[model samples]
Target chain A: MKRVLKLAALGACCLALCACANRPPAHALDRTCEMGGRHGATGVLEYQCVDGDGVIRERPQPIHRVISGGRNG
Target chain B: MIHRCPWPGEDPLYIAYHDTEWGVPERDSEALFAKLILDGFQAGLSWITILRKRENFLEAFDGFKPETLARYSEADIERLLGNAGIIRSRAKIEAAIGNAKAWLAMREGGQDFSDFLWDFVDGEPVQNRFASMKDVPAETQASQAMSKALKKEGFKFCGPVIVYAFMQATGMVNDHLVTCFRHDEVKALSRSS
Candidate 1:
């Protein structure tokens, strides 16, 4: 009886860990920055990736970066 | 003296707009549409110019109700052009009408305008902590995405820079300088919303 109870507790812990691993991170649902629109000559557009804990990490470049021409609005 | 963003300068009206309205998250769909159209007219000109003419623009554009402006005819265009109180550019006026139609189209498709726009930021105002105007950006990756999406949806004059300015004004992002008094106040507003 004691052994069965210990095994049951261990199974529950393993299931919890598996559930956590299966859940997607917040950043996965977050948008990746795109750059096909206008940007200033002096300013740089920073693309950041925020982790599940809301920690922002600097991303070097977006997946797409196109420079378009237009007057600054 | 209360430390504030230096861009407002010494102009009383600009100061008032900056203090009371700027960076306050606006959830109203109609109000957002009005500000976007106004910002479009603000292209190639100072925002203060548009700010001063805002009331006049509101009066002229029928409070920027998308339903009303979407149905404006050529005569209405002529009437708007003749009005000296607002920006007199035919292109801008025509774009405003087209934009109103686009706005309606979005609504007709069952998309909530505010939710569509807010989704870019994941339904919360981005809290940016810049210490000075020089540190602030003219455009961001999010604004770039927004500009592209708006253009695809038939919006005109909504380039990334314009979109960014509109975002700042509508509180999609809090770009207030850390030294400015309203920075924390605006951030609090974001949390409460």
Candidate 2:
């Protein structure tokens, strides 16, 4: 019984360590921009994410379209 | 290209944010305010902690409206202290309310924080072709200028490093990896802008 209890405790500790090891690193959450193409041209596109209630989330799904100096209509 | 969501092996909430919105540039003033407050709360805490409590932040902070949040009273602060949805740090919680008031004051002075901020990048986005994550930097001169200006304006929790993160998130700078699919896409967008 004593040996079985020790094995159980060891297993629990390993599981806890495994859980901690799987956490994401801080830098991974940093914000960034997604550029679609080249510079100084009308085709250049950029997109950022914001919460759903905000204007940044107004774009269509799958692909959020942004054209510089152009109306959304 | 593994294309794993930026915050790998985290809960689905974080994974979804990573894959969909982590680095996307945001320009709207209200959205910017929301992100700014959230990032401030994220200081010295794992992002997963912030992500877990995002809904609570939104609810407790009146959806992050500068005008609404600026009016939060001591009672509100006390209420938030006990809320499980946000980081309960007294300093950070206080900073969010203070920053909101500062933002409101900026608007009162005929300055839109969005316009003020986007102007730093010359009304356009900076496109960087980083080959890997390591190639990106945590702070830049532009961020330093922004941090300085924000501090002058009475905003808190906006240090140079955090300002750079803010800049990247709002499309003032694009740090996507050159080989990553999003890099060229954002670059193309900037040229057209």
TM-scores, chain A, per candidate: 0.34, 0.32
Per-residue CA lDDT of model 1 for B53-88, tens digit only, reads 788989999999999999999999889877878877
Best-matching candidate per TM-score? 1
After TM-score superposition, what is the CA distance of residue B36 in candidate 1 from its true location, in Å? 0.2
lDDT of candidate 2 over B79-166, digit per residue (tens):
8877766667677778889999899899999999889898888878888877765567667888889889999999898877667767
Clashing residue pairs in candidate 1 are none
Predicted structure with the largest lDDT when compared to the true one: 1
Docking class of 1: incorrect
Error of 1 at B104 (Å): 0.6
Q: On a 0 to 1 TM-score scale, where does candidate 1 land against the true structure?
A: 0.73
Off by over 4 Å in 2: A1-73, B1-11, B191-193
